[model samples]
Target chain A: MTTAAEFQIEYLQYLQADGKAKSDLPSFASDETLMVNLYKTMVQVRAYDTKAIALQRTGKMGTYASTLGQEALSAATGAAMQKDDVFAPYYRDYAAQIQRSVSMLEIYQYWGGDERGNCYQNNPHDFPMSVPIGSQCLHAAGAAFAFKYRKQNRVAVTTIGEGGTSEGDFYEALNVAGAWKLPVVFVVNNNQWAISVPRGSQTACETIAQKAIAAGFEGIQIDGNDIIACRKIIGDAIDKARRGDGPTLVEAITYRLCDHTTADDASRYREDNEVTNAQELEPIKRTRAYLTDVGFWNDEKEAALQVECKKNVDAVVEQYLNIEQQPLENLFDYHYAELPANLVEQRQEVIEGSL
Target chain B: MNELTLVDAVNQAIAHELASDPDVVVFGEDVGKNGGVFRATANLQDRFGENRVFDTPLAESMIAGLSIGMSTQGLKPVAEFQFLGFIYPAFNQIVNHAARMRNRTRGRLHCPIVFRAPFGGGIHAPEHHSESTEALFAHIPGLRVVIPSSPVRAYGLLLAAIRNPDPVIFLEPKRIYRLVKQDVPDNGEALPLDACFVLREGSDVTLVSWGAMMHETLQAANQLSEQGIQADVIDVATIKPLDIDTILNSVEKTGRCVIVHEAARSFGVGAEIAAQIGEKALFSLHAPVQRVTGFDITMPYFKLEKHYMPSVEKIIAAVNHTMEF
Candidate 1:
């Protein structure tokens, strides 16, 4: 006789790609104002992304990772997170950062290579944007461990790309979170492309969510293009974590509709036909169709929303450009809480030489 | 006051910190119930409970990354790696995250974590167990690299590292973990983390060393005293922000300097010390600086380990060369 452990992975898609409702939505979906606000944030993030790319082309900004077709993951994540919880984000989390009160100018400043851009006046516990792939998952696990140790009802949520699932940090984090029963949730943004490498070539596993099973946790897949599904799934995972129900892995299936960064040329590696197909299933148009079907939004409202987003992006860009550069000592100052004798001398030498 | 070995002193310091501060936590592979491979964290689990002291999966990256995570949220994490050689897996986390967390966040987030690892070779351990790569960590800007030479310094420096508000890599010299004993007072007093301790003072030649090499350095100093060549021995407790002033002062009086370390000779902490002395005290030096260090080759097996280690005779030879010059 053979004994085998059977496992089932759940996939959620409440809103179809064509903006049609596939099933009855969650209670929060009935809140038209909340849905409209989420839609507006996505629009704002897209506008910022366009402006950033334009600035890079004009030699004004540095290389930037575009959120392009994957804004729903960040939108739902940022909206569902509470003030008390900590968020450890990856590089492409502009919408999430904006929702958490990190100003657009600050994000631009960070991309411009200014360390002071990470100094968020609000959400002091929030970690800086992790540029190193899946490392933020480990940080999320550690923060969750702190919450569990203190007996606090807070959860840590981290985001990673599909390619990041193959990293050792991702696997180890999920393992520790399961073994220690920490309150954490990992949201994998399966945008189908990690630079030139496609999602299929990144891992041999059936789905990225199934990788969590090896670490003994629940893994769920959701339609990342559907805002209602994204919010519901992330909110549920966060609630489960807050209830001390170990950790959960939510894989948001989406597509990267643009180059990885301003420095990368996707046209050299990817086909235009595939990009065109993905654009049809992008998040913004689907969400707009859903809102129109619900009678909550229309073409007139969208036009006005686009104009407002442009104005907002333009103002933030001006502020970012006009901001004064910090003194040179700022580089050596934050290295430690107090400068030691050697560093003090080095700082003095640098200042004197500059003078 | 209690007479404790270096390992016992490390345990005492960790337990003391865990008791005095509720936010302090300790964890590593086999560190909880097993009390660590070398028993440096012995009896800490029972005393501090499982919540404060625990075991983690056999993953160095997670150990380092978790410490970074726990530290930013008002907790002081003292994470132990099984051995210094195993720290390579967590190199990215250490250099990219732990060392840069403070500066990257511009002081908004800081990691108050202490990564403790048993380093150096002498006990005939297997490969990947013995390494003195202190220079690699010290090279990173945002980290404080500290090593303890004796029981008292171990206890005091560990307490200081645990209480420090920044990330610190506390390297415990495994070769001297129980090599000697000293009376350490449990008064919760911590030694400074950025200063050096002068073990012996003299005016003939300055012998600079840290970690386990201090043992042979002191022995060399004693032997040199018998030969009428009094040597000033300096234990560079904090290797990163080196106490060069103390070394320079000793060199100014002695007019000669001899550095010793067990790590590979190229780009070691000794090289940094020699460079600083050459730049600052070129006029005071009566003779060129000499270094007695391990070879650039990988550490050999148990039988040949003695030859690879910097022996007392080699230190004496370096001292003789500097004095004769």
Candidate 2:
């Protein structure tokens, strides 16, 4: 049931459950080497997720959250934007960060409790991973406000879950963005759960995107698991804002196919039927199948892509796991322009106490 | 020098900062054309232009957030909260964002912004207008809370806050804004936020306080001096990152201290000063750190505001008692 929009449903089936891009996407990638690089990045990011889960099982990371199920959504949405466009992601969007040159090792380091993991050689084209619910939206809006004030065409995109819209900052940021007509694309990744609370408990509204109208912006909902649909949704919104139409609220209706995080056990609160059904609509698998029907399927190419993806991940894992852990003194750093006396005292005590 | 009241000095500071630094912009509810609720920002728009001084929407968070946005982009912002009580709506942005922006950015971003608000009891104002919540902000690491007691200090400290490279919380004691006047230095003076100004030195005891309470401390000092008990009046211009050297040095010399503040007695600015003295100057002191502070009640409306505040009587009582120990 494709509408007049550019989104295609069957094209969602070309990718495998394992995250390989289907054959049809090759054309989109071939002409734009950027897309192929984006594809490889998605695969590696997924692998990184898998490794993080494994690491968390043994106490390497503290309460790790996953983008395992939303890899395609992040990749497709990120792929639609260029480097100059700003992305403000939640703690769960390392997939988007990787494409922006936020190193895998840094992600590992941050999940490992190091702010240095957050440090980037470049701007990473993203604001910091916002930990507080919906706070990043304000930062995104502020960046867009800055861009608008300077009359820049660069779009600032921020992501939040359904639960985030309930935060006061969410309403505040939305009001500011809409009032100022800032060039921002707000993607509410309706992942259906905030921690143990389900989306239904967050709001009575059928969709978060519709809330945008109340805040003075047009709202749209799309199947987040459908790559073509996601790309079309994000691309159109970006274009509209670039032409100075102000902001748009995009609700990418996606499911958290995996448990919310490594620490989560969906079996406790979520029914098995729901997970199984969502698994069937995994964005990567749908894209691969769509490519196969479009003459992009071949066993050799699939094997090669897997090897190439795994090789990159393994190399990164080696680099990440082996990077010297952040020194304890680093905890006291990065908090003030001038290191206050108390912090210096605390740092010294920590060093001495550790000794 | 201008024969200005404390409120006039604040208005003067806003006008002077706006004139001196093109980057220094001032805005809050009714700050434009209306000139702020207390007229602290009166006539700034006419002098500095709307771009340099103007009114913000009724939203406190937006006012603070917009300031953060503006400051990060190179504008020096002096954001006002129409009243101390109304400032809580923007507390999150102030505490979580503005306070931490510099440290979070690894010093790459310096939030040279000042939050100006009239605080403490005395006026029979609304519940939120007569609050002494500077202690909450002073406790936060990256923030420097400066409380001005008189016209002279207000002009100097307000200017220094603007030039200071960090986010400075300039808490204007609403009660004292028009209560007093003084000979303000011609060009004003810059006082370090981490230092205390010893207003009057004595050997029997030191009276330590800031903001509105400093007036009461001075009054108490005058009262103590009348009885031949030498009293040192120490004005803690800056509350956070307390001026430990000055505090300890005074206590060591006088061997006694009476901390004063208009906030509720429990965990107010006085508590920090007392605790620090207890920890660092305990052996040097002749008695436990005595604290004269406001009653632990929501400030009453204007009729009882004076009684609700810590007074010369209370400070005199605390100082007299400390002599027993």
Q: Which candidate should be chosen as best, given DockQ against the real structure?
A: 1
Q: What is the lDDT of residue A344 in candidate 1?
A: 88
Q: Give the clashing pairs for model 1.
A: none
Instruction: Compute the lDDT for candidate 2.
Output: 0.76
DockQ of candidate 2 against the true complex = 0.36
Worst 10 residues of 2 chain B by lDDT: B101-110
Cα lDDT tens digits for candidate 2, A100-193: 7778777877777766666655663466677767767776775675566556778888888888988877787778778778888888888888
What i-RMS does each candidate reach, in Å? 0.7, 3.1
Residue lDDT tens for model 1, A1-355: 6744467789999888898989998988879999999999999999999998898899888888889998888999999999889999999988988899988888999988888889987768889889898999999999999999999999999999999988999999999998988899999999999999999899877899988788888999999989999999999999999998889999999999989999999999999999999999899999999999989999999999999999999999999899898898986899999888888888898899999
Displacement of residue B40 (Cα, Å) in model 2 is 2.9
> lDDT of all predictions, in order shown?
0.92, 0.76
What candidate 2 gets wrong by more than 4 Å, as runs, is A1-35, A81-85, A151-153, A292-298, B11-25, B46-55, B66-75, B101-111, B183-189
Question: Against the true structure, whose TM-score is highest?
Answer: 1
Question: Measured against the native two-chain assembly using Cα atoms, what DockQ does each of the candidate structures obtain, in the order listed?
Answer: 0.90, 0.36
CAPRI quality band, candidate 2:
acceptable
Model 1 chain A weakest lDDT span, ten residues long? A1-10
lDDT of 1 at B199: 92
- For model 2, residues B75-187, the per-residue Cα lDDT tens digits are 67788988878888778877777787665544545567888888877767766678888878878877888987888888888888888777888888887888877877557
